[model samples]
Target: MTIHTTSSCTAFEGVRRIASGALRDVAAAVKRAHDRAGGEPILVFDDATSSPIEFDLRGGVDDVLARLADAAANGAGAAGQDDEPAAARSRGRPKLGVIAREVTLLPRHWEWLNAQPGGASVALRKLVDAARLARADNERVRLAQEAVYRFMTAMGGNLPDYEEATRALYANDRARFEQMIAGWPGDIREHAAKLAAAAFCEVT
Candidate 1:
């Protein structure tokens, strides 16, 4: 299976967000801020993870831009390929990192699995895979909500209606969340909305 990922970054100057976009764009924004604002602590964060990313700002804007360009090029090339090698399947067992683990189940459950096509192990694998596929959307929404909450806690924790905003976030109340943060700084509000965008259902 191939796993695809999207990368986003945000740069902040004190309490205010300065920029948010692709890695290269955010890096450029941070570099520009560092140059124009002197040593005033400019923090860059991974929008998905809400963690601070450190860059060698001492190397100047051109060097920073060059590094970002190289990284983006490398990432683009790598993203097209699967991380795993394709291998032929064996008769009874496959070489796809199958691990042996003891799963204690009731006798009836064991009997049901044993009666399925390809017996217990294959049946279990199929069931697990089906469940994973079914839950993928919910998992994505949960992860997106968590990411947005983390970013908000770091950026808007000191802002007005912080607790109410948090409640609205977890409650999946996009409208209320937006209303709570309506008075926040433009950049911060926009970034928060972007982060939480995936977590909410359309109001229709």
Candidate 2:
């Protein structure tokens, strides 16, 4: 999408009033002319500093379109326009190689996780991946929580009641909840801890 910007001046009035959806190149050129003459483009929205669309005014329609095509392909902006800063560059979906924030599990939590079929490291990764997938699907954190309940129902799991565990955690009595969970089956205990950690943030 070629976003063209132009000054709100009388000389470039024709550029500003171009046919809807057409003449973006002319608009861009006019804006460039205005900029060269030392005026800033007027943003249409009260909340926006710049137009949602940007335009490049370096040449004729074909030339501008060619440039726009190239930019669209390569994700570049206008010729003299500043490249997005490092902070603003990473927009859209999260990157695969980026480091995610770390959440520390208590010793008992680790012990519980270790008792799972895949052990602590694998289990934690699985939990994180599951949470990410749920978030992507727009699943409510509470709704995504059915996984914890399911895990608890498995054989040799420690948790006797998913609702009670969630209630204690939601109430902020972490110590009491952890104590209640310590005696459950190992897998249930591990799963509850994961749920608690995930739900804790949503609740607060």
Candidate 3:
């Protein structure tokens, strides 16, 4: 998936952190690091998603930054969208970026939605917005868990107690999770906690 984020990103040369900051700046740093032979492979991850960002750093710094800008401008919209055919979904409001994808529902569900004042589409939108607001805290925790897990798979896969640490992470036992990774490299351990800040929140 083509992803874009304005937030910060972090890069690691094997287990050693080499850079962390704005995406473009980090890319430049990675290029410089790659030039210094005898260094470990570099992986740059988006702070928002923990996914390794792919950008061509082949040419000069300016060239890399230019390509990054081009990417953002043409960012393949958002990821994880339904793969419905273009003809199936309607362009309700092209200017507002409103895409109308197919929604499957039972007969009774459709009846209830159509009965609303503004009809099915409006009713569905309102219901979605309300549900998102109500589940904000739960959503935050879920995203954090995903972020932490993604990073762990990439960076801590071979670490001692990796399996046990994963179990504690998903179990929401913050204490146990910390203990599982206590012997990990300082940078890796600290980063895991940083990524999980929200995952361990006391959700209600």
Compared with the true structure, all predictions reach lDDT values of 0.79, 0.49, 0.85
**Model 3: residue 6 alpha-carbon error in angstroms:** 3.8
TM-score, candidate 1, is 0.63
Query: What's the C-alpha lDDT at position 159 in model 2?
Result: 34
TM-scores, one per candidate: 0.63, 0.25, 0.69
Cα error of candidate 1 at position 197, Å: 1.3
- The Cα RMSD in angstroms, rounded to one decimal, for candidate 3 relative to the true structure is 8.0
Question: Which clashing pairs does model 3 show?
Answer: none
Candidate 1 residues 2-105, lDDT tens each?
11133777789976778877876777788888888355678777877676677666687789777666665677788678655566434576567879999999
lDDT of 3 by residue, 1-204 (tens): 244665789999889888889988888898888878898988888887797876687788888788887777666454435679889976675577689788899999999999999999999889999888769978888889999999999999999988898899888999999999999988888889898878997664
Off by over 4 Å in 2: 1-140, 155-163, 169-173, 202-204
Q: Choose the strongest candidate by TM-score.
A: 3
Better of 1 and 2 by TM-score: 1
lDDT of 1 at 169: 83
- List clashing residue pairs in candidate 2: 3-53, 3-54, 3-55, 4-54, 4-55, 157-185, 158-184, 158-185
Off by over 4 Å in 1: 1-6, 38-40, 66-130, 202-204
Ranking by lDDT: 3, 1, 2
- Residue 4 lDDT, candidate 3, scale 0-100: 62
The alpha-carbon RMSD values of the candidates against the true structure, listed in the order shown, are 7.3, 22.1, 8.0
TM-score of candidate 2 on Cα atoms, chains taken together = 0.25
Ten-residue stretch with the least lDDT total in model 2: 42-51
